[model samples]
Target: MPRTLVIGAGVAGLATAALLAREGHEVTVLEKGTRTGGRAGVLERNGFQFDTGPSWYLMPSVFEHFYNLLGTTTQEQLTLVDLDPAYRVYSEPEPGSAAPHPVDLPRGADRVRQLFEELEPGSGPALDRYIASAKRTTDIAERRFLYNPFKRLNNLAVPEVLAAGPELARLLLTSLERYVERRFSHPVLRQILGYPAVFLGTRPQDAPAMYHLMSALDLDDGVRYPLGGFWEVLASFRRLAEEAGAQIITGAEVTEIVTAPARRRRLGRGPRRVATGVRWRDEHGVVHAEQADHVVSAADLHHTETALLGEADRSYPESWWEKVTSGPGAVLVMLGVRGELPELAHHSLFFTRDWTANFESIFGAHPSVPTPASSYVCRASASEPGLAPEDHENLFVLVPVPADVSLGHGGAEGQGDPAVEQVAQAAIEQIGQWAGIDDFEDRIVLRETIGPADFAGDYNSWRGSVLGQAHTLRQSAMFRPQNTSAKVSGLYYAGGTVAPGIGVPMCLISAELVLKHMRRDYSAGPLRTEPQRTARQSTGSRADGAGD
Candidate 1:
């Protein structure tokens, strides 16, 4: 059996360690913070609890696979309750308009269709058609497109994947805005259908059309919350990981990576020099070191290379680093209230008054403070009262902003106590106006704030970015950081910044891919003199290949 060391105990790191241990590898998960979830950490204050990140559970099938792999089912670990009337959108009635109407986006298809029918008689059928098309695209993408380990565009040699090429191209060019405009006449419906991409760190205009599939996920699967909030989901993972005999060590920061020189033999030439062995620092100032047959780093790629690999290392080129680096950071607010918010649904979106201008401010013009921008306020506990104490509520409010490429207010500086307070007050006020609660401030009995800077300080998220790289087509799939580092022989990557892209499901899939590779390599035994065939060579045609 080989010894394995996994850096970072976030979802990806934990999942990696758990799977490896279950495979009988002596695995150790070292986390910098005192907790395991990192950004998914929970905040508890005055008998109220809040899930700080990933409030909604959309692609539950992914979580189910993870649980089943570990010998437990989703039904046993946590209860996923479907939220009806998923969310409400409060559009500031059109300028100088007499009517005051807010959009109530229901959870399932039948209700959503009825809601659309109420807006425009024929729109219900259009929505159904739109969902059907979206589902078809998602099927291809999930079953085919996403499975390309992303070695290169040519890696997808499967027939079904190639056959779905036109679908991908169509989905790519079709903007959610234009698609929604073609289907719905109501401004609110258009905004609702076009809004989910905000989490992607780009406006709907820049977001690829394929992202509409994400919207379809919400509409088809419906928004769900675990009985104890998203934190409970993490708790379930922690329990399962521990049950699998994985050692989880929190408050263990890896300060340095130690290595030894070795020789690399060429195909026709003599041995070439190379450095090997993995080493890092523990939570205490003192250093600790261990040798491993393999290592997996779920942390930021840049940090892994520069800090761990050091200078003069020739693992990846500068061009690859430039392409897979950090993206936008976010400013988030968590609140606990005295009484329940009656009007607010499980989720709410307040679109910026000027969508185009908002993008300009975040990406182009830049801002000095947290400005009025598109925001998502999620009350997971609102739908599942079991998460909060009697008569109390838990809420998480988030706003995405540019990364701290500069020492700016909206990025790292936004995590400061003063900035957090200002942003919190502003967000509470904005939510009050949107919810039409005149005295909403009076209901707040508890409040806590987190921002991109917190991601940097607590989680070591490069540039304080929560979502890793931007989700543009250029930054996706094989274009994303590879699961296995070509530079470091035993090194691998899993999580938001790597292949298969971000989100809970993607992270879980990434872990599975890593495990699959390990099992394949381990069962095959030592390497042969001849280089193993690439994923492309191994699978000759598209029809008989994996992921097709």
Candidate 2:
């Protein structure tokens, strides 16, 4: 069996190891931290288990597909609980209004349509039109672009894709902000449609209208949570990888990817790329070298290219990143609250009225944390009470800021670096005001803040970006970095930084892309795996990433 060494034990890395191991390759995964899950890590404190990363579970079919590929099923591995009133959108107070406008997003398409119609009179038809367009774009993206390896242009020349040329062109050419504004007049509705851009690592104004597909997932599909938070999902991945006979070792920090010069396969071609092994330091700080026929770096793409490989073997060096745009950094505040935050829903979004100001504060020339930053709050205890002690809540607040580690690192309670504390405190205040949690701060029994610097220190994140690269038209789809290196033939990559883009589903698809590249199976769509078992009935109550 050919030996494979996968760097990092993030979702993508574990998925790749499991898939490759099933193909008879001897896979060994190296994780820098003491535990797996990479960005989807857990924080346990005083009987509360907080999911510090990637809390929202958006795509169920995608997870199901992955489990099927692993000779299992989502039902067999996961207990998914549908979250009613999927999420509540907390918008800034209306003129003369004493409180903020909180819209509880309902489940199913018709109710969602009705909610929008209620919000903006005579908007039901326009909302339907938008959903149709989103569905079309989503269909095209899933069938053609998301899984396409870009090995051949002909791969995407299917009849439906050919038919969508004009519509697709229009979507790609326009901005998400323009797309929403053309259809909806309500400011909150626009914010709802535009916010997904942040998840993609760009402002809505800069993100291509093609991403309107996110609405298809957000509204139509509704949101759900895995029983134990995202940590449960990570546990599933690790379990599958182990069951497939892949070895995973934590605290094995890789020093360098070993490589050497090699002769070209054809006389006309340049020197053939090669990665023979890797040099790493184990938990004991002892350096060891291990040989592998293939090396997959699932760490941050920029770190893999610039830090691990030699200058001679670098496919994307420092000069290349000078032109690359990083996504926003973030200050994540994890709190174990004393009481049931009845005012807050399972998921709440505090959207500022000045949406452009918030986006500019993160993406503009002089990026800084907005005074009343638009943020996301996930109260896991709302759905999974087991995550926290009885009568308490496991909550996390994410405030997007500039991708700069200089803002400082995180620490326990009132001890965080001043800048990070400023951001986190402001978010806490904003949440209390917008969500109507009168004594939000006083209820906090535990507090831990994660800032941009922590991402750099823990994950070697380039520019301390929480997500990977910004998903501008220039950095998305085929425009993003490919899975394999142009300079190192056997060195592959799998993570949020490469295509098909950020988020958990994208990372799972990225793992499959590596499988496609290795086996030369460059089909346009995801490979079909026979159904292992039909998903059973619901039991309860859902990014590959650096520090989600």
In every candidate, how many clashes are there? 5, 5
RMSD of each: 8.0, 3.4
Number of the top lDDT candidate:
2
Candidate 1 per-residue lDDT, tens place, 363-453, comes to: 6654544467667888776666766789888778886666663432332223445655576677888788767777788887666677666
Candidate 2 Cα deviation (angstroms), residue 128: 1.0
Report the CA-based lDDT of candidate 1 relative to the real structure: 0.69
The segments of candidate 2 whose C-alpha lies over 4 angstroms from its true place after superposition are: 94-97, 535-548
Q: Compared with the true structure, what per-residue lDDT tens digits does model 2 show for residues 300-364?
A: 99889888999989889999999998999999999989978878889998988898988888999
In candidate 2, list every pair of residues with a backbone clash.
Answer: 81-540, 81-541, 225-542, 226-542, 504-543
Lowest lDDT 10-residue stretch of candidate 1: 522-531
Residue 239 in model 2: shift from native, Å? 0.3
